[model samples]
Target: MQIYPAFHIDKKITDAADEALRKAQPALKRIDEVTDYNQQKMLAAFIHCGVSESHFAASTGYGYGDRGREVLDQVYAQALGAEDALVRYNFVSGTHALTVALFGVLRPGDTMLCVTGLPYDTLQSVIGLTGDGNGSLKEYGIHYRQVDLKKDGTPDYEAIEHAVQPDTKMVYIQRSRGYSLRPSLFVEDIEKIAAIAKRRAPNCIVMVDNCYGEFVQKEEPVAHGADLMAGSLIKNPGGGVAPTGGYIAGRKDLVESCSYRLTTPGTGREIGCTLGNNRELFMGAFHAPHVTGEALKTAVFTSALFEELGYAVTPRWDEPRADIIQAVLLRTREALIAFCQGIQKGSPVDSFVLPEPWGMPGYDCQVIMAAGTFTLGASVELSADAPLRAPWAVWMQGGLNFHSARLGSMLAAQSMLEKGFLG
Candidate 1:
């Protein structure tokens, strides 16, 4: 049964959460200020494009004359500080958007360099490391090279210096840690690495896999120097409203090329109807900044709570947060399962369901995901996932409301205690 906080809540944990909320007031205020700035910018994009009620109408057949499609692109471009953007419900997930961006800019025989160590696991197959029996990048003749992060998990600048050669047509940077223990990259870090890529390989396109890193900060990776950026609508940009989609924003030509890849050679951005998703897209963009603030606060609270309980957390409570994600090193499989199961207890969607680790595809090991989101796989609506591998970590992200997220975290703690993993 679901434990409603209205009557059956634990006073001790609630009191601690209240104290934490009080301590986080200042950071929350700063978040609101930046959110307002971003909101205004997005609104201006809508106004500039002359959005109308009919823009929300769905279209069919090559999606010709879809005004809503155009406006969304404009809104996303402005919001992400890019010259152009392609925001569509068609691209599916973050990985699909990233694949389009990579395929659009990279031709056969081009070498791609990853400066931020290994990328998210999903990209491994896309890059042809695995599942390359089909039309993978390497199957098309693209070369891939990686400059692993230093022992301390920082960018390997010397390795990057040596790796950015003439044939390196694309240099990749993943802003989020993505199953890794390293801290997520902030704009400053993106800038530092982007500058090196530009200086060494001036013609090489610098692309950022921007999943889970949008709207949490005022500025985006495009503003830092990335030539192209890609992310999922269900993550941060959707503002917990958009049902499904992905976005690619950056330089005009690069964005256009991505659109071409998304559609076809002659079609490009001119096609792909909104399919009645315009309203959700606009509303999501408008609410993304505020929603992101809530998620960030929840992450802050989670960090402090777990740290107080004697467990170490990556990017500690008051660290410079670049994303909503908060990783707790549980160190044991028993603790990991119990912790995630506890979070499921507070979920409105599946409060009674227990999450178990399984062999989820696109990942090496059995992974567990606690995604009781309002929109299926919406990460911005509060969710958690971690691969049941060596580190035995639990990665938590998003919180529609801080209170709800707090309850989940507290429940997670209680579950661990009940299992004797912690007491």
Candidate 2:
């Protein structure tokens, strides 16, 4: 088989991956061992928010009372392995959860040094970039500073330390790239950031935006000594099980504060007596590990294949994958669209439809996607997206099962071959 150029997987790594793939083939052959891809796609379509089921399910005699809070607390603790994880199906978005956490922990006039430069694209609006006529941290009087990423995409520790001020109440670190110019931050990098935060200012909160990076690494940020870790329910942590929701896990006090900020003041100590979809969130958390692992494998394989084909693959699999995203630089608008169309056809999300770039609200330019039309990011089916940029690159993410990802990848290659672009 031909290897991709951008990935730089040598003979040894390729051999190891091959052996692992062969070993897994038999185990994967059992239909009962895996969830159906089409079923997952259908589930993705209906889930609008983490609270959808709560909106529909008949109240189980558990009003927005103590019982509801207890159920939420139990579910959160079970999913995160943190004694004090705060899982709220109510938080509308991952940014909402992070904002709640930040607002809860940082007092007004307190500084929030951004250890990881600008956060995800959506968050840029929230952090006061243009205000863009939106509410954000700046509106709350939270001062912000940034430290650019290192050559390998990790944060600069010394620069972070320099940025720290006496009034710094929180140090924000984003694990996933989050629509930034930099690449993803690795687990070790997170640990290092935690160490710096602890050494320079023990009282300062160490928070991470663990969105797409959740469960992709062996150890979570909490394990690496981060004070708090937050992510979207629609992303990796949802595990194709959480119809909608996001999560925040970490130290007891901080999590408690975040819980309070998530709901009405004084209501944060417990899962607010608000109704929540406990069953779906619970199930999604249960399957998260395996689903995230499959997505990671797909990313690795796709990255390697595309790299071998002479495309520029970011976060090249020379080292362990930081997350499930594999961005292939197509360098041409025509090629990028073709690549996305092929992946979309393989997806259960509107398989017959072709995707095109169109203007989206809250963004500067038109964006394109090739999956089911839902907002909460739950499309586990294979798809690709790219912002219009010079040397245009299409970033591909997701595949509920490795088998489907493998097939999609081969089809992508076949598409390229048909266009005579592989030569």
Candidate 3:
């Protein structure tokens, strides 16, 4: 006998979801094709690097001559089409990896230009835009400037060309949309930005924040022209398995510099220990492409469902996706809360817990989040979150598998309907 009662999904929501799936067919096919190509690529990387069972062994303090650690880096470098890479659990977050890259390449008198306009909120403190100036880029005497995106939310190529200067040591590109409504950048966009940066400032390094953008398409930023890139492992690349980590991949010399920043200058990538996390990390890399495809499908389904329910959504069901994130504009605080609560309810873990808005450390506004992931804050699993502000948009990403993700999205809509937030 079944131990638990079957959960109810309203007929209205189910009907809407069925319609949304019909509309999402084309996008789903594209995702499958990309997944196949990326899977082959990842397999090639593993074979090329000669990944073996012995490579999964752990090392302790000092960790000298750790073969597994070295091979892990090689596999990532091959997979990302980078000359070198630093993959470590020690880096903590995507922001930390980005910070290391920034401090590694820049000097006291150098300037860093952001072509994607102001970055996400968490980066503000690192760039010295918010918080006390302690250890920020500005405090270290690195100048910062940005060329805002065009009114249509595309990069201002001409403006970027003009903005590059002799002292511009790094050109920053953010691949994900962050909390904004603008479209996330594609690898082609990164290539163009890199070409412009190299043309205007030959010595400048083109760096990309690749979070949420990996394995979505056939090519990564490094393959297209970016000199360096960084991301959190807990996102798409983690395959929802890696407990904690981040990666920086790029030109060999630049990667070495980042390694220096990650550890002490003399120690660099040579010293850190894996502490038995190697197996999960390697397994995560192997499964990343498929998991990312699942997330993309879920995002598309959510987009179509919300659109069917008469709400605005970014990168509609049939649109080409650059990342897994799906943004739904609820337009009211009550609806936003209800949608998030619904997502929490549908979660496999902590289904009964009610999520509320609170002052999250990185953001300027009170943020509400619902994540019942096995690994806390793992965005590769089904999750939804939003800041309490105007337009009331909730950014949803990750679905380890499409079936569960679709149900979670439906529950969100059902919650809104139950509360009369939907017509």
Cα lDDT computed for each candidate against the true fold = 0.85, 0.67, 0.92
Across residues 1-423, which tens digit of lDDT does each residue of candidate 3 receive? 111247687777778888889878988999999999999999999998899999999999988998999999999998888999999988789999999999998989888899998898999999999999899999999989999999888899999999998668889999999888999999999999999999888888999999999999998999998999999999998888899999999999999998888889989999988899999999999999999999999999999999999999998888898999999999999999999999999898998999999999989999999998888999999999989998899999999999888889988998999999888
Candidate 3 stretches with Cα past 4 Å from truth are: 1-5
TM-score of each: 0.95, 0.81, 0.98
120-154 per-residue lDDT for model 2 (tens digits): 66777777875452567788787788888788676
State which candidate has the highest lDDT: 3
Higher-ranked by lDDT: 1 or 3 = 3
The alpha-carbon lDDT assigned to residue 238 of candidate 3 equals 84
Compose the digit string of candidate 1's lDDT tens values, residues 80-144. Answer: 88999999888789999999999998999999999888889998899998885378899999989
* lDDT accuracy of residue 402 in candidate 2: 79
* Alpha-carbon runs more than 4 Å astray in model 1: 1-12, 15-19
Residue pairs in collision within model 1: none
Which portions of model 2 miss their true places by more than 4 Å? Answer: 1-62, 66-72, 78-81, 269-276, 373-376, 418-420
Native-referenced Cα lDDT, model 2: 0.67
